[model samples]
Target: MSRFEKLSHVIWHCQYHIFWVPKYRYRILTGAVANEVYRCIQIYCGRLGCEIVELNVQPDHVHLLVKVPPKRSISEVLGAVKGRTAIRIFKQFSNLRKKPYWGNSFWAKGYCVDTVGMDAEMVRKYVKYQEQLEKQQEQLQF
Candidate 1:
């Protein structure tokens, strides 16, 4: 009946709209790379007990709306997602690691995040809409 989550000590509803780009903002997150990124994020979120409301992986950056529990800091969630995704990306796509320019990193140093208190639906639609727009643009390019 309630969107709030219950912990042993608190009832909370924490959602974040997070965005981050690849190192150097490279446009390499296409095709298999994008798929892998999604898989990695899902797994990491599940492991951390976070709920993903929406996610989109563009060629340069990622858009995620997640419901994180109060016990976890946003930085902690971001670190886990970024760190795990990077390691898996390098392992699965070994060519990326071979590139000297990548310089031992998959994501950049910082990310942008904002809390979603009331406009949750709006943000969710925005994420999905962006993905659709991206697909349409891709079709026109081909």
Candidate 2:
């Protein structure tokens, strides 16, 4: 079932599959760091009134299936998610800065974003599935 946002004059369900990697695509996200990243993302998204349908933090990247309000653009939502999570993760994991690759950033410069259409559940399952696919196989349409 889909839970939509109801504004004064409209009701909408906008879901997106977002994925991003660590700086330089390093596989630094694991153990405590991975858990903290997941927690920070959930907290940040919750603060924005966004629902995280599914989330997976791989060793080198992260994925999230989220439902956001129509009033906010994808960039705005991503900024909130990425920007805030970076701050939280950095603060909680100060040792990350010691690594040359990580430096002053936790996430890379850009991310992948795709809208979900009528079959939202299908997309959620796709996000939840653990098996990694080749880059070409991951090219999905909304």
Measured by lDDT, the strongest candidate is 1
In terms of lDDT, model 2 sits at 0.84
> Model 2, range 1-142, lDDT digits (tens) per residue?
5466787988998999999998888897899988988998899888888889999999999999998887778888888888888888788877777777776677889999998876778877787663455454666531
TM-score, cand. 1: 0.81
Q: Residue by residue across 21-140, what tens digits does model 1's lDDT show?
A: 999999999999999999999999989999999999999999999999988999999999999999999999999998998888999999999988867788899999999999999999
TM-score of 2: 0.77
In candidate 2, position 75 carries an lDDT of 89
Instruction: Give the top-scoring candidate (TM-score).
Output: 1
Clashes of 2: 0
Residue pairs with clashing backbones, model 2? none
lDDT of each: 0.95, 0.84
Model 1 error, position 12 (Å) = 0.7
